[model samples]
Target: MTMLDRRALLTKAAWAALAAPAALGGCASPAPLRHDPFRLGVASGDPLPDGMVLWTRLMGAPAAGADAAPLPGAEPIAVRWEVAEDAHFRRIAQRGVATALPELAHSVHVEVRGLAPGRWYHYRFLLGDAVSPPARTRTAPAPHELPGHLRLVHASCQRWEHGHYAAWRHVCAERPDLVVFLGDYVYEYPSPPDATGLARTHTLPLARTLADWRERYALHKSDPLLQAAHACAPWLVTWDDHEVQNDYAGTHGRGEPGDFLQLRAAAWQAFYEHMPLRAGTLAASGFGQLQLYRRQPWGRLAHLHVLDTRQWRDLQACRAPDGPARAVRPSACPELLQPGRTLLGTPQERWLREGLALDANSQPVRFSVLAQQTLFAPRHYPSGVQSTDSWDGYPAARTRLLQDIADIAPRNTVLLGGDIHQNYVCNVETQVAGRTRVVASEFCGTSVTSRSGTTQDKVDAIRRLNPHVLLARCEERGYCVSDVTPQRWTATLRAVRDPLDATSDAWDLARFVVEDGRPGPQPA
Candidate 1:
C-alpha cells in the first residue's frame, strides 16, 4: 500500500478500537462490561399525582475508581427507559431516550409523566441489549380525593460498617406505599478507629472529593438488601449532615468555619447524582443547590411537608473544634437562646409557615405531617442541659414553629423524624404564659444499623425532664412503619435484635397511636 493509504488505514483502526466497547453491548470494563447494567438496580422518587422520577445509571466498563464516576473520557452511553402497565411491559405507557452523560456519572433520571393517579406502574431501562431489572412505582392520590389509608415507612442512619441491612430487607418485604428517608444515608468517614466490634468495614477513608463521595455512595448501594428496598417502592428522601460532613450547618462546618465550600459542593453533587430526584434539582453548575423542602399530599387525608434542616441551619452552639458532642445549660451557652438561630433557613421557614397556614385554613387537610431530620419535640437532659445539635438547641425556632402549629390548629398534626439512632414518641408542646399545651405528636425512628449515641441512663434522665416524652428506646436498630387513616395514625417500631446477623428476624417491639384531634401518642 502507498504511504497515504497506510496512514488512513491506521486512523480507521484507532476509531474501530474506540468503538469496540459500544459494539459489544457497551460493557466498558476490562473484561468487557457485563450485561448486568442494573447492578445498582432501579429507583423511583418524588411522586406526584401525575408522575414520578425514574432513575438508572449506565455502568459501562468498571472505571479506575470502582464505578466511582466513569473513565475520564468515556463516550456518552445512550439509555432508553419505559413505563408499562404490566410487569411484562406488554402494555407500554411511556418510553424515551436519555443520554447518560459522563459528566454526571452516567446516571439517567427520567421524570416520567402522564400516569394514572394512585396507580402502580412498572418501569425498566435499556442500554443496547442489556436491560435493567424492572421496578414498580406509584403516583400520589388525586387532590381532594381521600385515600382512606396510607402506609409508609420512614427510616434513617444506615451506617454500612455497623451491621447488616436486614432491616431494609424486611422493609422491602413489608412493601409500604412510600419510603421517606430523613438522613444519614451514608457516613462520610470510613470505618473509624472508635467504631469497635463493627460487623463490616468501609473500603475507603473520609470522603473529601467528588470521586470519594461517589465511591462512598457506591459502597452503600452495593448492598443487595438496600438495592431491593429501592427497587420495591418510591422514596422521598432528604439528607442530614453525614451526606457531607458530620454536623455541618448552612455554610458552616461542625466547629469553626474553614474552606469547606468546595467539599460541600462536591458532596451535594454526589448526592443528587445517586438519588432518584427530579430534573429540577439539577443546578447549572452541576452542584445540588436545589430547595428540597416541599409538600406532598395523600389525597385530602394527609399533607406531608418534607423538610431539609441540615442545608439551611445555624451552627450548633458551643461546639468545640475537636472533642465530644457538646450539651450545655441555659447559663453557659447564651447563644442557644438567640431568636435568630434557625434550623430551617429564613426562606424555608417562611415557605413552611405559609404552607402550614394554607393547609390548615384554605386546604383543610386532615393530618399535616412534618417529615424532617432529628427530633422536633423538646428533649431536656438532666440539670437543664440539652443537645446543641437537635431542636433542643434551637428553642426559639422550635417555639416559633410550634406557635405556627397552634395558630392554624390543624385537626391532626404528626411529626416524623430520624438521626438520633433511637426510637422516641413525644408530645410536641409549647408554653404560653406559663401554661404548657401539647401541639402535635412526634415519632422519631431509630437507625437502620448504627449504634445509638444516647445511653440508657441519659435516656432515662431525659424522659424524667421531659414528661411529654411517652416512650424512648436507645438500644434498638430498626425503622418505623406508620399506618394512617382519617380517624387515627398508628406507628409501630420494628427492631432487629441483632443487626450483625443478615438472616436475623425483626419483630415489632412497640406500637403507639395518636387519635384524631389529639396531640399525644398512647400505647395502642
Candidate 2:
C-alpha cells in the first residue's frame, strides 16, 4: 500500500475499534506467534486529554549485532495496536495498524485519540501472530475542567552500568498518575575499567554514530523494570547531557573540540525514534529538532513546564571547554556572571514566560510547576565554591528568571529538578537590592541508579553554606513522589537502601510541603 493509504488505514482501524469495542474481541487472548517480536518491551507516553502515544519496537533478538535484529527484511512491517478500558483488553477503546518502516528501526508510535479523560487504559502491540505484553496508561484530565488532585513521580539519571534499576521498579509500584523524567535517560559513554563494579555494561562502545546510539537506547529499553515504569504512567521527559554526550552544551562538548553537529544529529535522530514523543516533534531530515520544552497541564491543578536545559544552554564558564572546571569563587570566575550567558537560551526563556502568562490567564492554574533538569536553587559549598554546570553558573540568567517569577508571582510556584544525583529541598528566593523575597519552593530529586557525589557531612556543609536549603541527602539513590491538592502539595523523597541489589526496597527519606499561599517548602 502507498504511504498515505497506510496512514488512512491506521486511522480508520483505530476509530473503528473505538466506535465498536465489541467488534475488537479476543484482544486479551491472541494466538501466540512462532517468535517474540517485542523483546525490548512496550511503552506509552505524553498523554493528552483525548489521546496518548503508544510505542513498541519489533525485535527478533536482544543483542546489538545482526543476530539481534528485530525484523526479518528491509520491507515495512505491519503492526497492530489496541487500547482497552480493561487490563485484559476485553473492552477495546482504540486499535490501529501501523507500518513500521525499516528506515525508522521497525518501531511504531501510534497516537491514539478519542478516549475519555482522567481514565485508565491498557494497551498492547501485535506483529503478525506475535503478541507483546499488555501495558497500562492513562489520559490527562480535560483542560477546561479543574482536577482536584494529582500524584506524580519525578525521576532522572538512570545510568545503565551503575547498578540495578530497582528505583524504577519502586516507581512503577507507586503507579502515579504521571511521571516527569528530567533527563539523563541514557549515558553516551561506555563503562570505564577503573569505575566501580558495573551491574551491566553497554551493548556497544561509546555512541558516536546513529547505530551506536540506537543500540544503547535499545539496551536500556530492554530492562523489564524500566519498561514497567514507562508502561505504568504516561511520561513527560526532557534530556540532560548524557542523552547525547557528557557536559555538552548546544554543539560543544567540555573541551574535546570539534564540529559536533553531525554527531549531535545522529543522537537526536536516535532519541526521537525511541521516545514516545508525538509525530509533530519529529524532524524531517538531517538532525532531528524536537521542541522538548513545553508545558503539560493536569487540568487546572498544575501546569508542568518541562525544560530542555542542555539543548540551548551556553557553555560552562571560567575555564577550558575540554577539562573539568573545578568549582570557583565569584572573584576567580567573574565571567560566569556574564549577563549574556543563559541556561534556557533567549527563545525558550521567552516561551516559558509567555506560556506561564497564557496558562494563568486561561485557567485556574494553581501551581506553576517548573519540571526541568538541574537545580534552580543556588548551592554554596563550604569552600566558597559553586557549581558551574547548574543555575549557579548563569547567575544573571537565574536572576532574570527569578525576578520575572517574583514579578508575575504565580499563586504557588514549585521547581522540580534533577541531574545532581542528590536530593535537595530548598526555598527559592529572589533578592532585590538587600531584601530577600521567598518566591518559590524547589524539590530536587536524586538519581535512580547513579552514585551521589557527596557524603552526609558534605551535604551538611553545603546546607550550612546555603541557609535556604531545608533538607539535603547525598549518599543514597532513588526517586521522589509528589501529591498535589488544591490546598497543599507534599513531596516524599523515596531512596532505595541499595541500588546494587535488585530486591532493594525504598523508604521515605524525608517529606516536605508547600501550603496554598506559602511559596517555600516547609518540613512535614
- Residues 386-501 of candidate 1 have per-residue lDDT tens digits of 78889988888998898888887887889999999999999888876689988899999999998896688888877887789898889999999999988899999999979999
Q: What TM-score quantifies how close candidate 2 is to the native fold? A: 0.91
The positional error of residue 129 in candidate 2, measured at the CA in angstroms, is 0.8
Root mean square deviation (Cα) for candidate 2: 4.7
Residue ranges of candidate 2 with Cα displaced over 4 Å: 1-33, 62-72, 194-196, 254-259, 284-288, 324-326
* Candidate 1 off by > 4 Å: 1-35, 62-72, 193-196, 254-258, 283-288, 321-325, 432-434
lDDT score, candidate 2, position 420: 91
My TM-score estimates for the predictions, one after another, are: 0.90, 0.91
Q: Residue 377 in candidate 2 has what lDDT?
A: 90
Model 2 Cα lDDT, one tens digit per residue, 1-524: 34565455345333322323232332222245656788878878888898888878777644435324545567655677888999888998887776565556777777888999989899998776778899888999998777888999999999988889999889988979999899999998878866567776654788898789888888888788898888888888889888887777776774344547667867887787788876656433324356788778788889888898887898888757566545778888889989999999999999988877765577658898999998899898878887888899889889889987877777888999999999999999988778998999999999999877668998898898889999888888999999999899999999999888888999999999899988898889
